[model samples]
Target: MTNEELKKAALDYHEFPRPGKLGIEITKGFSTPEELSLAYTPGVAEPVLAIQANPEDAYRYTAKGNLVAVISNGTAVLGLGDCGALAGKPVMEGKAVLFKKFADIDVFDIEVDAKEPKDFIDTVARIAPTFGGINLEDIAAPSCFEIEDALIERLDIPVFHDDQHGTAIVLCAGLINALELVGKKIEDVRIVCLGAGAAGIASMRLAVDLGARRENMLLVDRKGVIHRDRDDFSKLNKEKLEFASAASAERRSLAGALAGADVFIGVSGPGLMKPEWLMLMAENPLIFALSNPVPEILPEAAWSVRKDLIMATGRSDYPNQVNNVLCFPFIFRGALDVRARTINSAMKVAAVKAIAELAKQPVPQEVLAAYRKNSLSFGPDYIIPKPIDPRLRDIVAPAVARAAVDSGAARLPYPAHYPV
Candidate 1:
């Protein structure tokens, strides 16, 4: 479709359907007067009194266990960048749709107008009791780190920043499969990351937790490689400072850092990676040019430069799409099911492993039909499970819940429905 046509279709999709992507639906019937009394006045009071007496009864009496609040400040709406909270409503609604459709989790998309991190954090914490889990979306870096940290510490519920850890989980999953294809170990590989924002920092940190060495990774922001000798080292945030590399005169630029690197993961903007730069990397390099709509380098362009390269992107047209949808819904499903205190590293790692393992299994007929492909297998071309794969809910959710229970982050035992 033409760009104009695509734009029109998207606008029409949201506008024609009641001017938004989401709507409220009453799960229980209340058509008759008797049903109404039982649904609201008398029956509702019983649950309210029960919850008042025992705070934990809210989960049993209300919809809180199945509900998620997808909150955002609109400061970082995808690649749009700081469009403000009101303008980010559509994306938040789309997230709600994903939650409901993928994992049967209900969501309320909240667009908070608070510009200050503390205010946003406070607002979410104050209203935490109404929902089972909170999924933070599209908040900017540095502040996002602080907001998520404070909220996680303050709230007993599972609080997660999907832009950071969700992207990290899926990225790490694909990377795990990609490394296997290329015969490279995460600890031994020389990694060059081209974005030092939320996704970049989080993905790199999670990679470290999964056995990648901190010293072996090079993190580059817009200014250049985040090296120790940089005069602005003090200006770096705590998260960014953890990955700062020792100053090397030869490794000041991205091109310099890419030299002999085994992997290149780009969360930066378009056209930042040149085709010729692919040659500077080690043989059989893995390139994840994950900038959306348009990647740092196009897949075809990268593949033409190096046939030995294993590439993935944030776009669906390409193979090995590192989509966050693969993480958040299932993660929340598992968290809510197990009543996890927080979506911790162990749960995230379980998600990573589950997604990675799913890709290695034979592609089911249903999945192939959805993609309209006759064949797909575990190879460089197919390193991650498709978002539409039906098995994701069952596979990822249980793994995450088990991890939460094992890690002591969960408040309840695993649900019988999700048996071991």
Candidate 2:
């Protein structure tokens, strides 16, 4: 569709149905006065008292177990940066729709107009009790780090900043399969991650957890490659500093950094990854140019340079799309089901493995029908599972839940409702 036509359609979609994308739907009936009394006044008091006596009873009596809060400050709204919190409501509501549709989790899209990290942290901690999990969205970088860290420390619920770990998990999932296809080990491969924002830093860190060596990673931002000799460690955020590479003088620039690199991950903007740089990458290299609408380098351009490349993007049109939707909904599903306190590295790794492994299995007929494809095989192009696959809920969720339980992050046992 043309840009204008697409804009009109999107606006119409949000307007014609109602004022917004979300609405409150009562799960229980209360049509009669008797039902109303049972739903609210007298009967509600019993559950309230029970929950007051035993805090754990809130999970049994209320929707807290199934509810997640999609909170945002809109400071770092993707595709449109620094839009205010009020402007970010639509995006937050869209997230809620994904949560409910994908994993049967309810959500309240919260747009907080806090000016600083302290205010946002205070607000979220105060409202923490209302949710089983908190999905932080679209907040700007260093402050996002601060807010998420403080809230996770304060709240006993599963708190995740989707822009960071969600992208990281799915990226790792695809990366795992991509490396397997190329017959290379993650630990031995060199990876150059462009854009040292939340997604870049998080993906690189998670890659390290999955066996990628810290010394093998070259993180680049707008200025240049984040080398150890840059003398800017004090200026870098704690998250970004973890990735500073103590590389030789030749690796100080983006071009030099991509020299024989096995993986080139671009969370930066469009066209920043020159086609020439692709030639410098190792044989059978992987490229994740994940900027939305336009990637770091277009696939057509990259393909012209090298046919031995496995490329991924954030667009739906691409074969291996690194999407956050594939991670957050089901991760929360598993975390909530098992009453996990935090979404730790083990659970994230389980999600990565589950997503990667799912792509290897023969495509189910239902999934094939959804994609309008006869088959999807485990290969360079089809590395990550499609976000629409119903199996992700059953497969990824149980994997994460199992990991949570095994790693002592879960308060409850492995849920019987989930598949064995």
Note the Cα lDDT for every prediction shown. Answer: 0.94, 0.92
Which ranges in model 1 have alpha carbons more than 4 Å from their true place? none
Writing each residue's lDDT as its tens digit, candidate 1 over 186-289 gives 99998999999899999999999899998889999999999888989998899889899995988879999999999999999999999999999999999999
Model 2 C-alpha lDDT per residue in residues 1-420, reported as the tens digit of each score: 999999999999999967888888888987999999989998899999999999999999999999999999999888799999999999999999999999999999999998599999999999999999999999998888888889989999999999999999999999999999999999999999999988998999899999999989989998788866776767877787788878898888999999999999999898999999899889998999999889999999999999999999999887898889999999999999999999999999999999999999988889889878988899988999998988899899999999999999999999888777
Once fitted onto the true fold, the runs of candidate 2 whose alpha carbons sit more than 4 angstroms away are none
Candidate 1, run of 10 with poorest lDDT: 243-252
**lDDT of residue 143 for candidate 1:** 94
TM-scores, each model vs. reference: 0.98, 0.98
